[model samples]
Target: MRELKPWLDLIFKRPGRLVVGGFLILATLLSGIALLAVSGWFITETALVGLLLAAGVAATINLYVPGGAIRFFAVSRTVFRYLERVYNHDTVLRLLTDIRVALFRRLSQASRIRRGELSGAQWLSRLTSDVDALDTLYLRLIAPAALAGLVTLAVVVLAAVLFDVGTALLVGLLLVIALLIATVGVYLRTWRLSARQSDRQEDLRTAVIEHIEGFPELTAAGRTGKHAAWLMRQAHQVTSEQAKADTRVGWHLAGSHLLVNLSAVVALWAGFALFQAGTVSGPVLVLLPIALLGLAEVYAMLPDAFGKLGATLASASRLNRDCREDKQPGTPKAAGLPPETALLAENISVKHSGYAPLFTRFNLEIESGERVGILGHSGSGKSSLADVLAGLLRHAHGSLARTDCVYLTQKTVLFEDTLRANLLLGSPEASDTELWGILEQMELAERFATEPDQLDTWLGSAGSRLSGGEARRVALARVLLNPAPLVILDEPFTGLDAETRGRVSKRMETLLEGKTVISLAHGSEALPGTDRVIYLSG
Candidate 1:
């Protein structure tokens, strides 16, 4: 929860927009209340005057003023409602942007330290669904609660001026009780239900993702039906939890409505008593009930808003845990070294969280303009070594010094964007000619040249439009564009055929001529023109 301070600060940084949005919300709620009250008084007064005139009694009344005031409030309510939606939505969108940026930045920094705790599905949920839940905090919770309070205060003051201090106190007390029932009572009763529903929803999401991604494996293993049954069970569980939550929310809403109606009835009875005592005029007495009715609209949303608090807090807590870094005492820090020395490690030992040490008393060094190949068997720390050198993993004990390096992991990542746009991630200032140059170096120039749009072709989500081999080449091309002196390629040609691998390996040697390259692969034959090879075995 404390990790949320940075995001909260970012949201309130632009107080002007927040203040204006709040003012618009307040204006809309108040205008609606005023419109109903004024309409009621005008109609009652006009009817009484008409009756007096019919009895041959002259009555002096100004219809123009009340009629104009009603018109003003009616128009203002509609206009303010529209403006409030537009302005508040815009503010929410801006806040979402800031939150996403802050969350991504924090995750990027803490990923190396908290890698074990953040699985693929959990990471996806935190970045997308969890971050999105925050909008409800502003739009649904804070804004509506604020508007209800403001309207309640206005109604109490109006009641006092129209009737007496005792009437004002009664109205205020009822409104306060209604608010407490909607917020505190609903929260206390429904929070556990909301949390259960949220948990089931996440389980359903994970189950569906697994079913889709593992469809081929399940079919091959003759367990497709079993997997399908499991998915159905998860779906049923989510539906059951959702039903329970909805039932609780329905009851809470019904109770809130009853309280609001009770308040309105009490206001009406008090107004009637004042009228019989001749303390309040007929028009004012009619206005009181209508104004109370308007208040129902404000209080109606409180039950659901408060019911969502549990889920919102749960999301915040999860995101905070993922984003916050846990620094270990006495953790080894990389030493500063000369730019010409690409890497140096002495007596280094590394281990994953809750796992045995992968590298014990390991020593390695690479100079500038050197190409080194790391060959190891499965579970022999090939990829782990790359991660450590790239500063993506912290070693438990080591004296390591390295220049900045660019890493191309086993999985190729491409966005839903033009080829040029993806390439620009490596070198933002690179021009079209430079991008094409790198593509040619990676043997992908002919593939894009045949496309109708060339560099402007839209690579569908996750580069789904490209073949596996083509996507790998694009990733390699992007890596080639990076200006970092030390380049780490982890299983770069996994899906390519033997012939293609040879061509790509040769081209990589040519493209990475002046840079320090550390190629991690299963066999030394995969790396061409390797100056040296280090084989790791347990």
Candidate 2:
């Protein structure tokens, strides 16, 4: 229901769509009534061939009116559809923005949670599948079903007045009963299937994503065949679950079609009996079936309509649970250190349930215009401290100073875009001269110089085609272009060779002149000219 609220709220947000949607509903019903009129003209004017021809002409004109109404109906439907996409897309994007912000916030605060805690597969599932689930709100059943129902109601009432009122009432009642019974049955059957399908889809998505991400590792370990088999198994499970869901939906639609046809036959038979008994005239008898035609169509369509609505509601329920469960941790206190104060962390500690403590009373202070090296063994809290200082992590116990910093993590993150675009991310207004200087500083200028397009060269998905070291250098250059007052680098020198590392270290030293730098390192090799060392031992 909560997931549905956003979509519903969107409809009411723009008053024009609501009013236009209602107008379309009325036009749809009047079109259906025009169909009945055309049929009646055929039956009543049969005695005079010439007059019947004239009535046929008049019926044609009446029928033409329905077409115009239908045109308006189509126009309104198209406009409403456009409005819905514009509104819903913007709304979902906004929600995604919030989720992204929160995810980064949690990553900063939750020290014990490694990137591995939410594996690539899990993150992919959340970003793509879980986020995609919200489509049920706008793209599925609500608007069409509501419009169809209202139009059906108006047509039914019109038919009742035009034909024998008793028979019209009886057909409407039967339709209601038929719709209610079918809807409940379809809901129960599809509910279980849809839920299972959603679960299996997530499982398959997770497995496939993980398998792809771990491809290099699996190949190196000679376990490629094993990973392939595991992926196939997940695919099989997803297919089986999807098949079951589809089968259930198909059966429900088939049964609903059968019942609707049966009801139509019964209604026609009853009308015939009334005609024979002199209770209804021939024209009126013909009118009875004409009126019931709309009901027949409605009955046929209603089951699927209701089924999809049920699926959408189920998706909404899942979204609500996820949003509620993953609420952000405690609001972090704003960093208290003065803006000009380089960087400071006083007795910062982080502890988590069911995990080893990440940091214990860790303390560090850096004056502006200083280069400091943070050295520690693997898991000695170097990366974690960098995260805390950069406002990406929150320590349970600490007072940290505020300082502008550009953080570069170990995993060189880049969008599938041109080199210039990625570098421009930090400072879009940077001049070409500044960019070339930074590239030279990172010792990545040679690669750019050799490229056919230099800075404009396309770096495909996460810079996959580039060597690990090159990707790292490019990311570093991007941060350098940003020129933050403070820079926090984690394992920045890992992938570089000896000569390149030396050049980069020298450039970093010069760049840090009169600036504060906090770098996490495995050893002092990358420290070049830093004057201070903070060793943390866990």
Local distance difference test values of all predictions, in order:
0.82, 0.65
lDDT digits (tens) for residues 132-221 of candidate 2: 555433323444446556655664575566546675566666555555545667677777667666766767777777778888998999
Superposition TM-score, candidate 2 onto the true structure = 0.78
Worst 10 residues of 2 by lDDT: 323-332
Full-model lDDT, candidate 2: 0.65
TM-score: model 1 vs. ground truth = 0.93
- Candidate No. with top TM-score: 1
Q: RMSD to the native, candidate 2?
A: 5.3
**Per-candidate TM vs. native?**
0.93, 0.78
